[model samples]
Structures are given as C-alpha cells and as structure tokens.
Target: MDVNFSKQGDWTIIAVEGRMDTVSAPEFEKMVQERILQGSNRLIVDFSKLDYISSAGLRSILVAGKNSKAKGGELACCGLQGVVKKVFDVSGFHKLLPIFDSKEDVLNRE
Candidate 1:
C-alpha cells in the first residue's frame, strides 16, 4: 500500500492507495503515530483509492482514531466504496468511525 500525507489547516490528511493488509498495516500505523507525536491531532483519512483492507488495517485505524480522540481532536474517513465500504459496514466500523461521503463533506463539517 501507498500512503500519502498532506495538511489542510489543522488537519493532517492521509490518502491511502492499494491494499492495506497485515504487512502494510504496521507501516500505516507508524506513519499515523509519527504524525500524532508531532502534535498533529486532527486527522482525515482519504480512502478514495484504497482497494482492500484487512483486519489489521482496521485495527490500525481504530488505534489512530482513539489516539486522536484522546488528544482532544478527531479522526474521520471519506471516499469509501465497493468492497472497502462493505467491510466497514459489515464490521460495524461505519457506526464507530466518522465516515463521510466525500472529502469535501469532511472538510466542511464542524
């Protein structure tokens, strides 16, 4: 998987591409952790190009979300589709995580 990071205002936007499996999940987690340690609390995960995600990926996301929330910020995801959306829905993550239909929706929200 490929992870690209950018910043918009107080948000650290992470754009993920390809598959997020066991091997890649740790890398993803590491990147997020680094950002958090750098004092980046508000996060937006853009899964617009993500094709697949395993349970490990979900775990990583959960950890990142928790860390952000614990720091008095928030984490949100956008642009979910197909199998990825199905996984999230089936796993009940859609309810637990803040999900938006588009990046614009996330960016515009309070």
Candidate 2:
C-alpha cells in the first residue's frame, strides 16, 4: 500500500492506498511509529483506497492503537469500504477501534 501522511494541529492523518497485508504491514507500522516519535498522538487513518488488509496488518494497527491510548492519545479510522470494512467487522475490530464514515466526521468529533 502507498501511504501519505499529513498533519492538522495535533493530529496526524494518514491516507493508505492499495493492500495492507503481510508484505506492507511492517512499512505501515514504521510510518505509525515515526509519527508517534514525532510527538503526534492523535491519529486518523484514511482507508478509502485500501482494498485489503490481512491479520498481520490488523495486528500492527492494534498494537499502534494500544500504544496511542497508553500515551493518552486517540486513534481513529475512516473511509473503509467493501472487503476492508468486512475484515474489520469479522475480526470484531469495528468495535475495538474507533471508526468513522468520513474524514470530516472524525475531524469534527472529539
């Protein structure tokens, strides 16, 4: 997947394209860690272009989310559709993670 990152105030927004599977999970994890290291606590992941995600991808995000929470920060996701949404649904990650219908929704809420 191709990942693009931007910032808004204290929040870091990431746009991910393509598939986030075993091959790309580590790369994404590295990006996330870099953002955290930059002192960005609030995170919003845009999955509008993401086509697929595997267990490894899910695990990496879960770990990142936990770290963000432990740091008293927040991590939100938006724009997931089709198979990507289904993956999170089946894994019960829809409930575990804070997901939004759109980027505006996440930005406006909390």
Which candidate wins on TM-score? 1
List where candidate 2 sits over 4 angstroms from the true fold: none
Per-residue lDDT tens digits for candidate 1, residues 1-110, read 99999999889999999999999999999999899988999999999999999999999999999999998888999999999999999999999989999878988886
Question: Candidate 2, overall lDDT?
Answer: 0.89
Count clashing pairs, candidate 1.
Answer: 0
- The 10-residue segment of model 2 with minimum total lDDT is 33-42
User: In every candidate, how many clashes are there?
Assistant: 0, 0
lDDT of candidate 2 at residue 37, scale 0 to 100: 73
Model 2: per-residue lDDT, tens digit, 1-110?
A: 89999987778898999989999999899889878877887899899999999999898889889878878897899998999999999999999989999988988886
Error (Å) of candidate 1 at residue 28 is 0.4
